[model samples]
Target chain A: MVVQNSKSNILIVEDEKGLRLGTQRLLEEEGYAVSAAENGNEGIKLGTSKEFDIAVIDLRMPDIDGLEVLKEIKNVYPNTVCFIATAFASYETAIQATRIGAYGYIPKPFTPEEFIYQIEQGIKQRELILSAERLKKEREENLFELASEKSRLNAIIKSINEGVLVLNKNGELAYYNYAALKYLNIREINIGENVIDKLPSKIVAVVKTIFSNDTFLLKTYTVQIEIKPNNELILEAACTPVPHPDGSLAGVVVTLGNITEFKKIEVIKSQFVSMVAHEMKTPLAAVQGFLNIIVDDTINVEKEKRKDYLKRSIVRLKSLTDLVNDLLDISRMELRTKHREIENIKVKDILSNVLQMLELEIKKKNITVQKNIEEKLPAIQADQNDITRIISNLLSNAIKYNKENGSIGIKLGSSPNYLILQISDTGIGMKPEERSKLFSEFYRIKNDRTRGISGTGLGLSIVKRIVESYHGKIEVDSQFEVGTTFTINLPINLN
Target chain B: MALIAIIDDDIDILDASSLVLKSKGHDIVTATNTTDGYKIVKERKPNLIILDVMMEEPDDGFYLAQKFRKDGIKIPILMYTSVSKAIGMEFDKSEIVPVDDFVEKPISPEELVEKVENLLHLKEVK
Candidate 1:
């Protein structure tokens, strides 16, 4: 009968010549390729260099004991299956052998079939472990590829115009894109910095509150901050928290968008609407008042009364015309339709002309006017009409808002670099809020109505535009109900 | 007898002012435009002048006032304009409207008489 051949390679490590030779011959007869080692020292060397299907060793050996040799073999070749054969048959030895990575331990005097069966089982176990390891390695490679692809996509998202930022669990900036850097004017050093250290005090407080509360999700917050170099940056920011798989807090992501221009346009729109209402209301009130007086039969129907009503109606009509003119002036200025016809103009002459034009209203009020114009004041190079209008508006505002027996003072002087004109009035002065909006188009002090004052509310705005065109500066100082002063500084000569 | 000349682009204002001065028993002459007003002032040489700020042109009255001062016309000119006196700014003792006196539009006949009488009285004392 022909013997079946086994493809398992087995190593017998025994110090006793009789036992070592006996096991090697038995394994070879059972169709296993067998190698024999005289002691643990040789066993260790063979186990390291050669890949054995199963390693069977005697428990008691001389020079580097069986347990020590078994440990060495597993350390070098973790996939090699190991078994211990011992005549002592002690429970402690069996346990010790298994603990040190042995497949199984058999007592001496065991049958040859039993030894073959243990060796075959160890070899099959080793093959299963090696295949499982290869499958694990392939899965890890695929995971790394997916992670790299995600990183590339995130890099593209960071380059967009909208600002994006991520903060770590410590409230420190983990990542910020280029757009966020530009919007916040953040320097390279600021990256990975603590959020509280980089933000303003107000903003830091809000962020700290959000960070401390795990349940709160601050989706949107609008804040205005002065960025580096002192530019007003308005941002509409949204914040969301990133959570770990176990429902613990991980980090926060914030996106900020600039809204400075949007705010400016909104303010302009509101001011325009209020201006239109005031303009229409003034004329309507005047017209209505005069008509009521005429309709009242109780007041004598005398020639004087009739003439007074007619004169007032005319005045109202003129006021309406002036309002329309002011609207046209602003539109022209915005469109850049008006061309400046620059010419040499005498400063004193222009002041005198403005004064003369308003002389009637001035004298009627019994207001004292003092003029301190220098005789040798240099002629200014400007658009004569623009200058005249600017002076006229300033002067008119003063007298219109003055009290009975009030006084106005005008001073004209020249410094080395500029010609200055200062006009002061003892009238219903402006409050801080009023003064702030004084030069804005269609902005008028609320109390000005009590004085029966009529203005297009575009006078100061026009003055500011014209002054800026000439590269001049206009400063205003006023105390509420006390007095108001406007100081204009213009270039001495434009040659 | 004090002679007063009134120059205004608006006929109604010119006529109304003349009526006020005439009622006060002062001799009055009226001109409707800058040219006629200037000629009348140079020829008649009134004791006082009442000028309107807004003539056919907005600064027509201002130009006339300047021309009168340049030509050595020393008659105390009182500028009467439709522009409100409450709107005229005051600078020191001299108000923005450069004149001996000023009266706003829809002028009360009583106020008109009172200002003219006082100005004439001031002239007499001077």
Candidate 2:
């Protein structure tokens, strides 16, 4: 649009020299910047060369028709308003001028006031055309920006991990990502199509629940569902209402997240609880038997035998307490493992500490443990308690399962990459099948040999976790009724 | 009829069971381990025997019960089933664990006495 407060440029063309000069003088006196041409050819040249807001062309020119000049001016600057000024104003000429993009024509030999009024109307028309063109361009720019933003959002939704589905108020799928299709296992889907029937029944139920509820616009509903009957894939859906500004529901947005791993962990957690219960029940039952006999009125016990029963009951109860503490230790070891103090530790110290702890058992079983160490043994970087647990559990097993006068051999050696600790016992050994299940949680050997041996059954499971956490290796070698050996290889450096 | 034997690895179970039977005016012979339990039962020929389900070996009582039947000693055997027995089976799955009667451990003193008297009375009728 032409800038306001600046003089509007005007152009006048005529075959008559006096008329062209007179019109120019009149427009100049009216505070307009004017340019005049004597013929149609000159007008075309001046019109194409400079910008003008309004043009007045005279018809019946000698060189060319005034309509030709107007056509050329309109082709160059479509926003410029053109007018036909003719001495003989006729019905045919006025219609032809209007078709050639002229605002209105002026008659020759008119008063200055009449001519000035026509000029004023042409200026207004020129401003309207320019303003329309500016508005159209601005609208096009805004539409382009909106298109780009929509594509950018589509790209993000398609790549995000969580599945997204947007449904219209009519329950037709308006927008969705590939993740949504994959999560739902929907093979064929199209825009603006109803896929509710294709959804799993649980999710469909959620949708129906949302659409049927009166307060749907005010709440978000969550549903946990398996993808299909007895299927491993689990999904969690959050159906949130997309509302209009007037507090009315426009559509429902469903976001789905895969929670199969989360469900598996829950199953493992329950299995762990039952295992604890099973292990605890046996000891508790045994302790109850002892206590029952001691308190019975009909059972008259001798004084010395009563003392023995009381002492044995207390011992069994103490072991039960120890089992509970051990369970807590195992749970704590599995969880809250973020903070741990790692430092250089001596295997020798750990072994000696374990030996001292199980000294009574070793002495009672008459087990002779021989320690063979390489000179100048290197220190292993590990948590001290973890190493102590491994040693004590294995050492106690060696003592508990050993036959009278059986020998236990300990060998500590170092290779280039590993610190090897091996403990061998001439004790009752496991069959290959029993050895295989040794590290399983709550799995104790159920045969005759292991019946006499009391244990919490979680020692080796904890040992395996610690070994795997440190990227170390543990191996068991056994021949039933012959002997068993346990080997551990701890890496010197951690990455 | 007064001679009764109880076999269990848990010394407290053996002592407690023997005390409960002895108070009922029965002579009690007890073995804390499986081998001695078998020896006492075979030698003494007790009228009825209470056997713990597990001793030095799991299923020691079951094996002893089978052995007693194989030896052609038909005196009633009271199986002292542990908690493990309740969840696994009540001597139902295996024909090998043949016994005349069953009593679960942490045994009610009254139940043990009642079971012993019933077995003796059943043996007299047989």
Interface RMSD of 2: 3.3
lDDT of 1 by residue, A286-367 (tens): 4544554456453334677677767877887787888889888888888989988888888788999999999988888888
Q: Once superposed on the true structure, which residue ranges of model 2 sit more than 4 Å away at CA?
A: A5-52, A55-66, A85-90, A107-116, A134-231, A235-257, A337-339, B1-22, B25-126
> What fraction of the true Cα-Cα contacts (under 8 Å, chains A to B) does candidate 1 also have?
0.00
* Model 1 regions lying over 4 Å from their true place: A1-260, A285-311, A404-406, A428-437, A446-450, A479-482, B1-126
Q: What is the fnat of candidate 2?
A: 0.52
Over the true interface, candidate 1 deviates by an RMSD, in Å, of 10.3
DockQ of each: 0.02, 0.35
Best by the DockQ measure: 2
Error of 2 at A322 (Å): 3.1
- DockQ of candidate 1, scored on C-alphas against the true complex (2 decimals): 0.02
